[model samples]
Target: MIEVQHLTKRYGPFTAVDDVSFKVEPGEILGFLGPNGAGKTTTMRVLTGYMPPTGGKAIVAGFDVFEQPIEAKRRIGYLPETPPLYPDMTVRDYLTFVAKIKGVPRADRKARLDSVMERTRISDMATRHCGKLSKGYRQRVGLAQAILHNPDVLVLDEPTAGLDPKQIIQTRELIKELAGSHTIILSTHILPEVSQTCQRVVIINKGKVVAVDTPDNLTARIRGSETMYVQVDASGADAQGALSQVPGVRQIAVTETRGSVTGFEIDSEPGRDVRRELASAIVTRGWGLLELRPMRMSLEDVFLQLTTQDAAEPEVAHE
Candidate 1:
């Protein structure tokens, strides 16, 4: 539903977005992740036609964003970092105004407003002044306005930025529910949110596309060795020796505790499953095995590796 090719955005001597390209298919939710000043917002602005790129092209729903901006934008619902709201207006009035600007027909404005208000759970606050609402309610109001036109694509920037934990969870669930029907490109620094709500991710750093793949695939790619954590009733030294003797075991470190118990982390070659061998070794050595489990890399670890790796090398502009 969205395609960006060789997209570059520059301001004078500095480049805000550097030759970044990616695609988002129908029913796909792509998580756009980056650090502060990473050009995530800049790229989103280019896609939304809020800013034009210095070079290359972007297409939304089969329409070129630059060539046919109005038609492209008509199919996109954008909720920017700050909700573009008129604080003086009541929730109902503000949304009604948004509907008109989005070109909702006069005959359909009322029903459109009603549906969006209900979808965003802001119906109860229809008569309340926007400025008088709490942060959560205001965020919901922003969401209502974004979807007021029933756009095919939703570009949400930090949809849960300032919400409380409960509200964040609710917002994530809402976004998940909206998937399949709406092609969404969500930009946020929250890793857990991406893991929970996005099927694929595109990581950006220094205004360049650093990595792109499903969260699990990215993490699995960086997982060089298999690691297992084991607890047993044995001295640290003895546990290490027994585990080291297991076939395929490359490294082992054990921590001794009182009552002959030990905690150990074992590292072996990638794709190796030595759990059974380790258990057999423990039993033969008369050590009581308390725990044995594989250790998987977390999203944070994967993010750090990919971003840091890119930082060390010369930046490669994508097309």
Candidate 2:
């Protein structure tokens, strides 16, 4: 349970976070998304009590971050963008140190360290020095520290930033396993990670909250129309003419053709599927259907639409 109300953070003349508000329900995984200078890290820092906000309040597990820093922090685990680690110390020693500092009972520190190491898949690297570990391993070590105390909430900033593809998948699976037991705030620019790992998403831009909802809802809101990409065996102009006559066809764009196959991007009105009509039209007109597939905008497209464009929300993919 995390609640941020009118949270604002400023540095001199620059405002990093401005009157942002959101709530993370218990056992929910919220994906925090934003562009390079969109105040994601600033918000996380404020919530984690790493720094005091210029204005507003942050409550973690029912404890005010500023007024009750100790209790709030004790119930929240934070992993920053850059893993804070002492290179000279082995992974086990580093996590053990973190557990102690985070107030894990001395008698429970060993079992706790071993458990986190195993959870993060860094058990084999327990004896390896933090400095000598690869970027992926280092990230695992950072995660191990964050979970060593098993806090009620976990705030992770780009937890999979430097991992390989396999490592990324493994990390995502681990995160999925932790979902129900720990409320997590995962901040990452990677769209796929958010789509696959988070239950809900929060997109912020220009120091303001743009949208907060399920990824499917956000994408559906932006890509309001059903789009289909078809390659028909006919002259490009002829193909367009045939498709334009389809009952639900709203718009059509002539794209590049491959060999004798002519490519067309067709859009139908909301809640309509024109594939059957498209196929019949091509066949009745004596044209061969080379390919027919739907085109759904990815989360990256949604991110771009909301962050880069002047629009206040994710833009429609149509021209």
Candidate 3:
């Protein structure tokens, strides 16, 4: 588990991470999201003990990161944006070195190193020099080292950045497999990754945490009435009129027409489920139905909405 309380980081006039607080339950995957310069990396650095906070506190795996640096660090496995790798060392040697440095007992070092290499699908590369590995293989080596220590907490910063599509998929699957055993804090700009991988998300903006919630809840909490997309085998104007007759329909735009099928973007009254009524009307009018579904807002929409929200909302404050 990981806990951050009113964490703050400042450099003269600029505050990088301001009064941010959040918790990650054991085995939960938390997605840390922000655009460039939003303090995501800064916050990660402080949590990983790479940098100290200007104010506030952080606890990792039951130990204060600042008060008990070694204990906290011992429980964390971090893969930074640019993984720390020794080019000249063979993959096996490098991972063995990592396991030893992380305090893997001498007797268990070999077994642990081999286990991680296998899990990361890097077994074949073990004998090859790290310098000779391809970019994707290098990334795998980075991931293997991070987990080689078998730490309870894994702080991965853009674990999939710059990888080919195949490699990205492979890495995501590996992280998912590690979820139940490792409390992960994943930082990335990739929206799809968050939706697919994280249980909850923390969105940072201008050095402050603006939003924190499950992806579904964030989108469902979106302001304004729901928008639904409908298609019917009828004239565009006719379909629009029929939908307007549905009791909850507030706004209807006949957006497109392809032969006999007409598409409509309908805004419904708040908290209304007008699908049944709309369907009934369409059938009664002998208009053939084609498609109907509510347009759920994507994670990208929620991210843009929260991060660009009016500044009037209070920023999380720290003493």
- Cα lDDT listed for each candidate: 0.87, 0.89, 0.89
The stretch of ten residues in a row with the least summed lDDT in candidate 3 is 310-319
Error of 3 at 134 (Å): 2.2
What C-alpha lDDT, on a 0 to 100 scale, does residue 298 get in candidate 3? 84
What ordering of candidates by TM-score runs from best to worst? 2, 1, 3
**Ten-residue stretch with the least lDDT total in model 2:** 310-319
lDDT of 3: 0.89
Predicted structure 1, TM vs. truth: 0.92
Write out the backbone clash pairs for model 2. none
Candidate 3, residue 267: lDDT: 92
**Backbone collision count in every prediction?**
0, 0, 0
Per residue, candidate 3 scores C-alpha lDDT tens digits across 1-319 of 8999999999999999889999889999999999899999899999999999999999999999999999999999999888788999999999988888899999999889888998999999889999898888888899999999899999999999988998899899999999999999999999999998999888898888887888777777764788889889998876776679889889999888898888998899889888898888898899888888998888898889888886925333221
Q: lDDT-based ranking, best first?
A: 2, 3, 1
Better of 1 and 3 by lDDT: 3
Q: Write the per-residue lDDT of candidate 2 for residues 1-319, one digit (tens) a residue.
A: 9999999999999999988888999999999999988999999999999999999999999999999999999999999999999999988888888988899999988888877888899999989999999999999898888888999999999999999999999999988888899999999999988999998898999887888888988888879788999998888887888799999999999887777778888999989888898898889878888899999988888888888777584322211
True lDDT of residue 183, candidate 3: 96
Clashes of 2: 0
Q: Which pairs of residues clash in candidate 3, taking residues 3 or more apart in a chain or in different chains?
A: none
Q: Model 2 RMSD to the real structure?
A: 3.1
